[model samples]
Target: MYHEQHGAPAVAPLAGFTVGVTAARRADELGALLQRRGAAVLHAPALRIVPLADDGELLAATKELIDNPPDVVVATTAIGFRGWVEAADGWGFGEELLACLRGVELLARGPKVKGAIRAAGLTEEWSPTSESMAEVLDRLLDEGVADRRVALQLHGEPLPGFVEALRAGGAEVVVVPVYRWMPPEDLAPLDRLLDATVGRSLDAVTFTSAPAAASLFSRAEDRGMLPQLLDALAHDVLPACVGPVTALPLQAVGLDTVQP
Candidate 1:
């Protein structure tokens, strides 16, 4: 442990630094944490998590899946799984849906999905170490999906290739998109964040999810500021991510990110 030569008073490590938060869920909590550490937080949620626009289609699909339970069920995200179950319960088919899932071979993409399944009194028979959809699909393919009925809970975004792969394997795939991520209706805050980032005013930007980072980059592209934004992220400002999955897009583009 090293100490100052003159026994200087202690101070917040992040004092005078400004951090940008691009998280939707728990954005306030993150802001509070940074504030407490003496960082000025700039909050600009690039994406807003909204309920599916058309619940009728999802509910009907759930009912059909329950009526003729799929041979395999893939749980992608905890939020999507919980939303699907809760929606079924709202439509009075919760117990039936749970029973149907109980009879199927359950596969989770990650610990979150596994936990969600367990919370619903269901068991997960398989999950991948990477906790990625691609990994989950690979495992399913290796196990043989020919003539199997597979139900997948999507994480809002469309996975056309994944579905195509399953279909090519002779599996009937039913996709359940429980929620969709919509860009922030007001672009003013995001615009401010973009300007500040490029101007080197923000010390760091924290991203909790990949979609949020993508959304921000998409906006910057639309404004023709993507190059400057990337430069800032790569050189001037520190880019932090919650996990590797969330840092994938940033890293792919040659932007180094700090991740826990």
Candidate 2:
């Protein structure tokens, strides 16, 4: 109708703009969303999600928990929690793991984690509505973790200071590494994205996770373009993140972001 009235179609908000996507999972979906807004999307996954199913580390941790049975179990993310159970299921100990967790004080970091726990036929003793690991940590400290065995299910990378703080409080913390964040096997696309970023060719870059942001910065540093990349991001390129957590890496380097 507007086109009919004006003899031309409305201009898309993102028309003539280029955006770089750095997500490994659901990258196509994100790129599609950006493209729908008329943005020229450049997809370069900064990192890859490596599941630890065959890595033996996850099995070892699962076995340790089954044998030792931690006093408190903290589920940090829905996918991580689900992946742990799925991996255990593949190893023929899913039910055993659930039974062990049933006896401990289970804690969920947010609603999604709570859903995963419930889906696994278990219930959380408590969950923070704020969806914050910090809040969960504070509660654990307040409840006194001295001499307590706590099993923390990590999503990808370690939560900054969380394990250290728990250990400092005399809690025997067993880290369950369900998955890992590794640099993408193919670095060519990432290199191209970095070049575009440093050249100020891209209008914006999207980060879905903190690891992706960190990986991008690491790559830039490795190529000796950190300063130039930082300058471009600071002045010309817009860094957009899914949430505050995903923005941590960018913020750590003294850069601001647009969270949507």
- RMSD after Cα superposition, model 2: 1.9
Give the per-residue lDDT digits (tens) of candidate 2, residues 80-120: 99999999999999999999999999999889999999999
Q: Please, what is the whole-model Cα lDDT of each candidate in the order they appear? A: 0.87, 0.92
TM-scores for candidates 1 onward, in order:
0.85, 0.94
For candidate 2, give the lDDT of residue 26: 96
Which segments of candidate 2 are over 4 A away from where they belong?
A: 1-8
Candidate 1 lowest-lDDT run of ten: 1-10
- In the range 1-260, model 1's lDDT, one tens digit per residue, is 12365677556778899999998889999999988878999999988877643566687788789888999999888888988888888888899999999899999988988999999988999888767788988989998999999998876555537889999999999987677678999989999999999999999999988788889999999999999999999998999999866887798799999987
Best by lDDT: 2
